[model samples]
Target: MASIARRPDGKWRARYRDDDGKQHAKHFDRKGDAQKWLNEVTAAVVTGTYVDPNAGRLTLRDFYLEWKTRQVWAPTTLRAMDTAIRCCTFADTDLAKLRRSHVEQWVKTMTATLAASTIRTRVNNVRSVLRAAIRDRIIATDPSEAVTLPRQRRTEHAMRIPTPEQVGQVLTAAEDWFAPFVALAAFAGLRIGEASAVQVRDIDFLRRTLHVQRQVQNGPTGVEVSAPKYGSERKVYLPDALVTLLAQHIERVGVHGDDGWLFPGVPTSPRNMRRAFDRTCERVGLDLIPHDLRHFYASGLIAAGCDVVTVQRALGHAKATTTLNTYGHLWPTAEDRTRVAAADLMSTALDARGDQLGTAEG
Candidate 1:
């Protein structure tokens, strides 16, 4: 039997103890609600699934802290993870006492405030912690996986994929400021840091390639030059236009071999190119960011009939999904490539002065 105590707020308190010699109490708005909760807790205890809140139990926040320390993520990445974890209402809730209902409510609250990507990131963080719990048998199942995920929102402000021609125009427009930046980003698909911190020696003109050995990072503590993001530290080929542009930039700026930084910054932080990029974009009449150039690059590769596997390697991405998710739209239609091949029978009729002839001639 359950005993109920009423408060001035018309709420009732339900009390129970578990086999672990731990006491639990909950306040409900109605006597019926109190009785129902008592039954639930009693049932949980009988099944050995009851969470003894009194047993110095760990909470969601506690689990996250433990898991975060074990991860070797970059400082920026860890900070982002911390932000995601803090947004959860269950961050401080007893991990053992946490139920599916508690997880669901937290998800709802997060969904109401965050974007799809933000929500996904936060949920993934929770999933990481809960998965470990599931593996350790702390919980019977992973509640994060069981809960429904919110739909990803596709907002207008999301990065835009530039057409091949537009990409050329943008580069031509910002010849001095962005041509090299655009080339490295579009042709080599280097992340901002990887590209910005590139040493003059990193450019292999003979092989038509660029080596990605390091990257610049701007974190809360300060700026630091570090290794590439994930396995992004690899070599990638460049297009003829970009190669020519890089060669010219080298000639104009002059390099002292591999030791000379390619695009030196004022504060010596190679990772701080966002402002320079934004200013260059304004001068070019294009409302695009440097990172958007990466999306445009992926889209261009896909449109140019490069396979996903090829794009993944070209961009130094650890996985094909990362390449596909960002620039899947660039994947050209099979028929489009087929039509170009099909038109090979009459090369003389369609060849003109200058239009992206949609030919494999490039």
Candidate 2:
């Protein structure tokens, strides 16, 4: 039930008790307005959608702090989200008062300085925070919804696959300790992080497969071993040559224990191999990132007539679409193969007709 009455200040006050027996009141200038507000609140309570107006007064920063504590994100993701929050313009604004214009303005401001991909990432982070606020009834609507973001442009130079000769040159120029790392990435399609985290126990000599279960990530705190990106734990087959090289390397390094890190550095850390990789690339007169080796591996698979699904599994991609988007250009087209097959079919038919004619004439 609800009640409306005149107050001492010449205002009408509406009062109601919620489902939990909590009393709430609001004052209006007119008795009709007070009555209308009371009716709306009572209906909302009966329908189980009532929200306490006072709860939404917290600023975005405060709400985000509360919301973030309850979330379980990967370390790298957590760092990115933290950066987004710290750099947001509306952090001090009230969650209830956020509007679409505010979000649009923020996007405009970010576009001036940040890359399109970076702006999208930061905006999405803020949008996710506000979405949680909506679920908690902190706001009636999400302001960040449908906000236009900067467009992302793909550049050809972003991903490059080196030729086999270039790969050979790089291997020849790399130090002995880092050569195996390059080989694993170039041949086995392992990301640099996954390659660095590989343990001796992860290799299956009999099956010639490497179990990719974890990756090394450098976070705000320090380097730590974490699950592979998107949990893409998969087994990638090893080439016979790579297997033999790994066996010889293991013997030479005198690493007898299965628990030892495949590429060991200081105590409790994987070796920082990027410096060595960069030096080797410079020596070999090639410009490449460590990840390019993984691209080279995919290109080789496609060149050797491997299907999309096989390449996807070899790369440990979470989705086939991801593999397609990254290396779709390298895959062979069905159109070309169809043309070749058509030509072969017509030639065979003509040859068979000639043979029948010769037999009939005889």
| All candidates: TM-score | 0.71, 0.82
Q: Residues 283-329, candidate 2, lDDT per residue (tens digit)?
A: 97899988889989998998898988999889988899988998887
Prediction 1 TM-score vs. true: 0.71
Q: Which run of 10 residues does model 1 get worst, by summed lDDT?
A: 263-272
**Over the stretch 1-362, how does candidate 1's per-residue lDDT look in tens digits?**
45789988888988775555456789988899889888887777677665444432677777677767777887778877788677777778777677778778887887777777777877887777777765544565566666877876453346676667766767776646445776787667777877777777788889988889888777677767777878677888777878888888888865443468776552135444776666666776677767777877776776677888888887888999887776665566688679888888457455653345555457
| Model 2 accuracy (lDDT, Cα) | 0.84
- Full-model lDDT for every candidate: 0.72, 0.84
How many residue pairs in model 1 have overlapping backbones?
A: 1
CA shift of 249, model 1, Å: 1.7
